[model samples]
Structure formats: C-alpha cells, structure tokens
Target: MKLVRPLPAYLVQRYHGWKATTFAENKSWYRRLAEDGQHPRAMVISCCDSRVHVTSIFGADQGEFFIHRNIANLVPPYRPDGDYHGTSAAVEYAVTSLKVAHLVVLGHSGCGGVRGCFDMCSGHAPELEEETSFIGRWMELLRPGYERTAGCEGTEQRLRALEQQAVIISLENLLTFPFVRAAVEEESLTLHGLWNDIGSGGLEQYDPESDDFLPI
Candidate 1:
C-alpha cells in the first residue's frame, strides 16, 4: 500500500483528451452501455502484449467482447483446489454468467512469454528455473507446448509453432472445465484459437479439421 502512486501525468493527459473527444461523441452510447450492462457475444483471452490490440484487430466496439489478458494468453487446466486462479475465474464468469457464445484464445508472433518458455525449457534461462520466480511458474504452463515444437528445424520456425501451440493448449485446457465442456456439448458455445503476426497484421485461425492454423 505504501508503494502505491497516482496515475502517470502522461496517462492522465491522454485520458482527458479521450474524455473530451471519444467520450463526448459517444456519450449516449456510453450511457446506454453503463445502464444496460455488458452482453458481449464473445470472450477473448489474449496475450498481455501491448502491441496486440484485440479491439482494433477485430474492429469491435465497446461491449462487443469480454477481454481477459495474461502472459502468453495461457489457460491452466481445471483444478478446483481452492487456490487463487485469476484466469480461471474470468473464464467461469464469462461462460456461466455472461453466457458468451464464443470463446477465443488468441496468441501472437514474437511473444516474449513464449520466448521465455522456450529458453527456460531449453535450459538456457536458469533464472526462470528458480522456484521463487513467479514468471517461471507461470511459464511452466506452456512447457508442453515447447515439447510439441522442440523438433522444428529453426529458431524462428520453432518459436512460431510454439506460439500457436500456446493457443491450442489453452483451448484444450478450457475444455477441462465442466461448465465450458457442457456449453460446448450443448452447442451453445464454441471455442476458437487465433494467432496474429503483430508486425504484418496477419491473422491465422485454428482449423480443428485440418489441425492447422490457416490464414484468415
């Protein structure tokens, strides 16, 4: 609590600018959203990378998508051990309460989290091997993905494959939740995996039939 500080001056300035322009133009829309509550059609679990603009990428408006961001966009397997699980909580709320129709796990190219996992699993990042490293523990969730892509021919190829695997792994984990599985089984909800190339703005979606990420 003692370490807490006020918002940065630059961010405050930016907020004021937005309030004057965007808020001013969309005042009624914002008011309606506030009064009606959110009814997002989809839940997007994406990487915490600043460059990955989920709203801009999909051209979605406010209240259109329930977004949850985390390192590597990972979703841990369902374990009702009474432990604190932020991502799991969000998924539960989105699926049970919000009743979102689609759940999307979005991964991206050149993800630092994936690189850290790659390095850690490759035995290069000893620091992440330490038990006290929160990042190390978090990145452990993606270790299986690293194993899947370990035999790729080059660094770039392996990294890209691993990135996509992160999405696949998360999609698989989502099914471990009984509610999510029930929703999917009832055909009321669907799961999707996507990988974005931040530099080129290209998007690829997972095709379960082909077992590949095809460009969209």
Candidate 2:
C-alpha cells in the first residue's frame, strides 16, 4: 500500500515513478525472513542523504547489507541514555542480533549535515535537531583533520575534511559498542571507512595501505 499509494509524496515521487525490480522479490523475501530470520552479509552505517545509497553503490542484492542512516552518518560515543538511540539501536541489532562481520562507515562529499556543524552554509532543516546536536558533538572527532587542514584551503576543502571526519567518527563509536568491540577483538568482524563523492561518481576508501583516503 505504501508503495502503491500516492499519499506519501516522497514515495510516490521518488519510488513509484521507477520500475521496481525488487518489489516482488522483496515481498517474498520479507515474509520468508520474518518467518525464519535474516542473515545479511554486511552492515553499513551511512548518511540519510538519498544520493549516497549503499545498495546501488555496492550493487547489493536483497538481504545483502543491513543499513543504518543518520545525518552526517554519526555514531555517538556509547550512551544508553542518549535520548535518541535510533542509530545505535540499529547498530546493536546489526552487530548483536545479526552478527554481521563487515561493518562499513560510509561518508560522502557535499553533505549538508556535515556543513551544518559549523553553519558554513545555511541548513534550513529545523526538524533535524538531533542531528544538529550530533553533528556538533561528533565533529569534534575530526578536530585533527580540521586543524591539519585549517587556514590552508577553500570551503570545499574544509567540507571534504568533514566528510572524512565522519568516517573516522563512525569507526570510533563502533568500537564503543561491546558487541562490536568484542567481535573485532576476536577477529570476527572488521570495520571499514568509505567516502562517496556523488558528483564525480568517485568512491574514495580509507587505504590503510597508504595511510590516506584514496580513489577506489
């Protein structure tokens, strides 16, 4: 109904217009998984931005990746009473419940949420208070990047640094989760950092090999 109906404008406009290849398969898949259980290959922590889709970016099939999205793709330091734990809850479910081995933190360039941290540009999204608070707090995790790149470049450079910082923040917060931490310590799970530049269709990865973000 949600997919067929036009009541929700976003769905009608964005999804209903497209030819859904997975709709039929997704219905059966959902029923089958609900009856039994789900076993996804990986878990992705990504931004709420529609352009940075994890599925199409990685060519993920049905039940391939469990995704959690939030503004700027933040993972706050572990706190049970964080008021808004929607992001963390999804992480908990992905790690503890699903036991996904590969966790990917996905960031992207030209992120409004990341730019909103400093209000370098106008972010008129009043409904995103949690993200407003979160971006403010989480950006601190990128202080080294800000410092390293400060007073040295244009606005675009700073924004790129913030995108990179988001990846670092997500990885750090993942370590704060006991389930995720234990899995990593036992060598059962591995964490990855990624940045997607939507404009150029460029995918940059955190190459530990080069100790820098590199084109992939």
Candidate 3:
C-alpha cells in the first residue's frame, strides 16, 4: 500500500481540464449512465498495448462498449480450475449479465506481448521461459497461434501473422465457454476477430468463410 498514492499533479491537471470540458459538455449523458447503469451492445477484448485505443478506433461514446484488456488480447480455453481468472470473469459478466450482442477480439501490429510470445517460442527470450514468469505463462496461451504461423517467411511476417492469430485464437476460445457457445448457436451473440495496422491505421477483419483476414 505504500506505493499507492494520490494522483500526480500533471494527471490531476488533465483530469480537471477534461472534467471542465468533455465531462461538462456531456453531464446529462453521464448522469443518465450513472443512474440507469451501462448496457453496452458489444464487448471488446483487446491487448494491453497503450497504442491500441479501442474507443478511439470505434469512435465510441462512454459506456457504448464493455471492454476487457490483457496481454496480446489472448483468451484461454474455458477451464474451471477455481483459481483467479480475471479475463474469464470479465467475459462471463459481459456475456451472462450484460448480454452484449457482439464479442470482438481485437489485436494489433507491433504488440510487445505478441512479440514476446514469438521470441519465447523461438527460444530468443529466456527470461520469459522461466516458470515464474507471469508474462511467459500468459503468452503460452498464444503458443498454438505461433505454431500456426510457423511457416511464415520473414520474422516480421511471422510476428504479424501471430498478431492476427491472436485475434483468431481468442475468437476460437470464446466458443469454449458453454454460455458463449449457446448464445452463438441461438444467434443471440456474434463473435468477431479484428487486427489493426498501427502505423497505417488500417483494419482487417477475420472472415470465417475465407479463413483469412480481409480489409474492413
């Protein structure tokens, strides 16, 4: 608790500035959201990368999307091991309680987590190979994704492939949850996979029929 403290001066200044501007302009909308609670139509699972801004990309308003973020935007297959499951817990709440109509697995280029997974799997990151490495264990969830892109030509191509694969893997894992599967089967929920090129600002969506990512 010693490390926890009040907001820094710069952040406090920015917060007040936003409160005086963006917040002031939408006070009524904020008040309604606070009173009625959120009922977002979509749930987005995206990477923890700071550069990948989900709300900005969608031009979404506050409470428009229920979002969960983690390393590489990875989703593990449903496992009822009775341990701490942050991402799974969020997905459960979004699907069961929030009843979000859409579930989006979003990935992006130049993701440090995806690069870490590629390095670890390629025997380049020994630090991540340690059993106690939390990131390593988490990145293991995307190992199968790396395997799928093993035949890719260049390192960049392989890494990019893994990035897209992260989205595909998460989409596949979403179906492992019984509630998610049932919702999809009943046409109550839809799953989507998306990858972004950070530099170019280009978005690609996974097409199940074509089994490839296509420009959206």
Candidate 4:
C-alpha cells in the first residue's frame, strides 16, 4: 500500500467536476441503485483497450449492463481446476447469480491484444515467445483464432478475420461451461458475438446460419 499514491490532480479535478454535475443530477438514481442492487439485462465481455467504450457504444445507463474487461476479451474453455480464473469467476457470477439474459463477446478493430497474438503466432514477436511473458501466455488463447485465419491472403484481411475470430472463439468457449450450456439449453440465456470498426463506428454481428459477421 505504501507504493500507492494519491489520485492524479487532473483526475481529482475531473471527479470533483462530475460530483458537482453528473452525480448531483443523478443522486436519486444512484441511491435507488444502491438500495435495490444491480440487475443488468446483459453481460458484455470486452477488451481492456481504452478506446473501446462499452457503455458509450450502447448508450447504456449505470446498471443496464454488467461488463467484464480483459486483455483481448477472451474467454478460456471451462476448466474447474481451482485455479485463479478471474474471467470464469465473472462469467459464473453474471450467469448464475445475476441471470443476465444476454452474454456478448465484443471485439473491435485495431486491437493491440489481437495484433500481439497475430505477431506471436506468426513467429514475429520473439519477446512474446518467452515462457515468463504473461501477455504471451494470455495471447495463447487466441492461437486457434490465428490458425483459423491462416488461409487469409493479405495482412489486413487476415488481421480483421483474426479479430472477428477472437469474438467467435470466446462465444464458443462460453458454451464449455456447464452453467452456460444449461442456461442456453433452457433458453434462459443467449450468446452474441460482435465486432466493431473503431474508425467508422460500425458494428457487425455474427450470423450463425451464414457463418459471417453481418453489418449491424
């Protein structure tokens, strides 16, 4: 705790400004949320990238969506081995405890994590090849996605394909969880995969029947 410092002056100033305006205006809503507890309709698994604003994108209110963020929005296959599984824990809580109706795996263009996975899988990033590299280990989850796009011709095309594949991979992995599978089977939960074009602010949703992402 000694290593921790006070909040940056700029952030503190911004917080005070928000407290004077946004928080004051929404004080009643905030109090109601505190009293009633959260009951978000959907759970969004998105990347830790700062540019990808989940709430802003969806125009969501404070408790409209339960969100979990990670390196690449990746969800590992279910393995209840009693290890530290942060993502799995969140998934379990969202599904079993919160009973969210929709679970979305959202990917975006120009994702650094996806790019790192591509470089690592292509043998271009030697530093990531190190056994001790945390990012490398995490990116391993996307190796299958890289393989799926290996046949893609151009780098741009391949990268885009891999990015979309990341969402698809996560959606597929979500089903490996017994709870997730059961919920889906009972028609209590639904899974969705989405890819966003950061520059254009366009969205594409995965279509199971066509096996492609259709513009949304």
lDDT, candidates in the order shown: 0.97, 0.78, 0.95, 0.96
Off by over 4 Å in 4: none
**What local lDDT score does residue 216 receive in model 2, on the 0 to 100 scale?**
85
Candidate 1 C-alpha lDDT tens digits along 1-216: 989999999999999999999999999999999999999999999999999999999999999999999999999999999999999999999999999999999999999999999999999999999999988999999999898886899999999999999999999999999999999999999999999999898999999999999999
Full-model lDDT, candidate 1: 0.97
Model with the higher TM-score, candidate 1 or 2: 1
TM-score of each: 0.97, 0.77, 0.98, 0.98
Highest lDDT: give the candidate number. Answer: 1
Q: In model 1, which residue pairs have backbone atoms overlapping below 3 Å?
A: none
The residue pairs found clashing in candidate 4 are none
Instruction: Write model 2 residue lDDT over 66-95, tens digit each, in one string.
Output: 988888887877888848788789988988
C-alpha lDDT (0 to 100) for residue 203 of candidate 2? 90
Q: What residue pairs clash in candidate 2, if any at all?
A: none
Question: With candidate 1 superimposed using the best TM-score fit, by how many Å does residue 195's alpha carbon deviate from the native?
Answer: 0.3
What would the per-residue lDDT of candidate 3 be over residues 20-98, giving only the tens digit for each residue? 9999999999999999999999999999999999999999999999999999999999998999999999999999999
C-alpha root-mean-square deviation, each candidate: 0.9, 4.9, 0.8, 0.7
Ranking by TM-score: 4, 3, 1, 2
Model 2, runs deviating above 4 Å: 1-31, 120-148
Which residue window of length 10 is worst by lDDT in model 4? 142-151
lDDT of 2 at 196: 91
